[model samples]
Target: MKHWTEDLDDDGDEPLVRPYTITGGRTTAGRDDLTLITLITAQSSSGTDTSAERHALQPEHRTVLRMCGRRPVAVAEIAAELDLPVSVTKILISDLIDAGRVSARPPLAFAQNGALPDMTLLEAVRDGLRQL
Candidate 1:
């Protein structure tokens, strides 16, 4: 099967920009709570004209915003999809969060204190999946 990154490149070669450059040489994310499973979703533009905002973002930032715009996506998934280092993806996402372009939250399936979810809820989810 063809590798996914091949489609992203105009030429069959490695990317010209390094991950550090993409993240402005930053190695750490602004938020310490961001985990691999953290869910990210785009913030609604509401009354603001988002076209202007879109124009100001870098291409990679815009791409991340577009991915999060559709639905909640996991931080790991974003890194994989963009073929960027997880650190780089987190930095980009952190910038968006700071700019009010996206929001991050823990996965709903996760319960507090690393405890298991209620059996009833899992059964209900299984039943819903069976219906689908």
Candidate 2:
């Protein structure tokens, strides 16, 4: 399959291109050679094609996507790269997962530790977010 954002993102591959804040997605039918992105828009707008806030990816989320594009990065990795607490990253990654923009599966046992592994980000973050 072709990459959705490969050539379409004419802007250089810097995470700075995306705006921070705003969240939501748009769903489109399968196209031959296009990557689909979903975005959230403010409710009351003119019926025409005016722009909404959530259309742009946030810098943090954009960096996460860029990292994911390079390889399958766990949510913790995203948190670490952004230097955000794991709880915050999970909230963001959860949005991505819920929107079908990303997927989550159980983590694997480390080469050193053979314990049955669980989803690290979810486990590590859940305890803290429950307090907030």
Best by TM-score: 1
Model 2 per-residue lDDT at 56: 50
Q: What is the per-residue lDDT of model 1 for residues 73-102, given as tens digits with 9 covering 90 to 100?
A: 999999998888898889999999999889
Model 2 Cα lDDT, one tens digit per residue, 1-132: 878887676665455422233223222212221111222211232445324533554666566666776446665567668766555566566565555555554444433465655778768789879988
TM-score, every prediction: 0.72, 0.42
Alpha-carbon deviation at 7 in model 1, angstroms:
26
Of candidate 1, the 10-residue stretch with the lowest lDDT total is 108-117
Candidate 1 achieves a global lDDT of: 0.87
Score each candidate by Cα lDDT.
0.87, 0.50
- Model 1, stretches more than 4 Å misplaced? 1-13, 50-52, 111-132
TM-score of 2: 0.42
lDDT of 2 at 109: 45
lDDT of 2 at 51: 45
Go through the candidates in order and give the clash count of each.
0, 6
Q: Candidate 2: where are CA atoms >4 Å away?
A: 1-54, 109-132
